[model samples]
Target: EDLWVEIQANTFKNWVNEHLRESGMQVTDFHDDFCDGTYLCALVEGLQKRPLKPSWNKRPANQHHYLENATTALNAIEADGVKLVNIGNVDIVNGNVKLIL
Candidate 1:
């Protein structure tokens, strides 16, 4: 089970790196990288190939800002027809790797 999780995590990390290559961003640790939501926003933008909602917190200093960014990313994802279930901004901010993936 742990190996399976690790494989999935690595696959996601590589996928994120692939999309974010031109942006000079990389995902080493899912928990820490996506915790602040900034990296997640970048990932979403890279995937969508466009700018996300302008409401994103470019500099998230507190939990509220982090949640805002995560919300924006999740909203964009849903707008792109991705159905997210059992996860929310708090889950992303809290570094829930399983749910975040």
Candidate 2:
């Protein structure tokens, strides 16, 4: 039942600003008015049947490229003899979280 820290909408804006600062990515602002109204969404997925499998070091997403990345990572995780859970839907195994979503 390990869930990610659900960052407040306003605070999350500041978080990325601070973290991505050294990454050289121009993270403008995380405010609604500034971002044209966008919120954070985290997709939690793991082994559905077995559930004991460990997820990829990378994270998952519900969006386009990220979703594709999730699929690839999941496939590799599965092939590694681990189980899986849903990324968006409820996970019946391994536990997951959708924080700040």
| Residues 1-101 of candidate 1: C-alpha lDDT, one tens digit per residue | 88888999999888889988977888899999898898989988988989998667777899989999999999999999999899999999999988877
Global lDDT of model 2: 0.34
Q: For model 2, give the 10-residue run with minimal summed lDDT.
A: 33-42
Q: Which pairs, if any, clash in model 2?
A: 46-84, 46-85, 47-83, 47-84, 47-85, 48-84, 48-85
| Global lDDT scores for all candidate models | 0.89, 0.34
What are the per-residue Cα lDDT tens digits for candidate 2 across 72-97? 44455467686654342122121222
Off by over 4 Å in 2: 1-7, 26-64, 70-101
Highest-scoring model, TM-score: 1
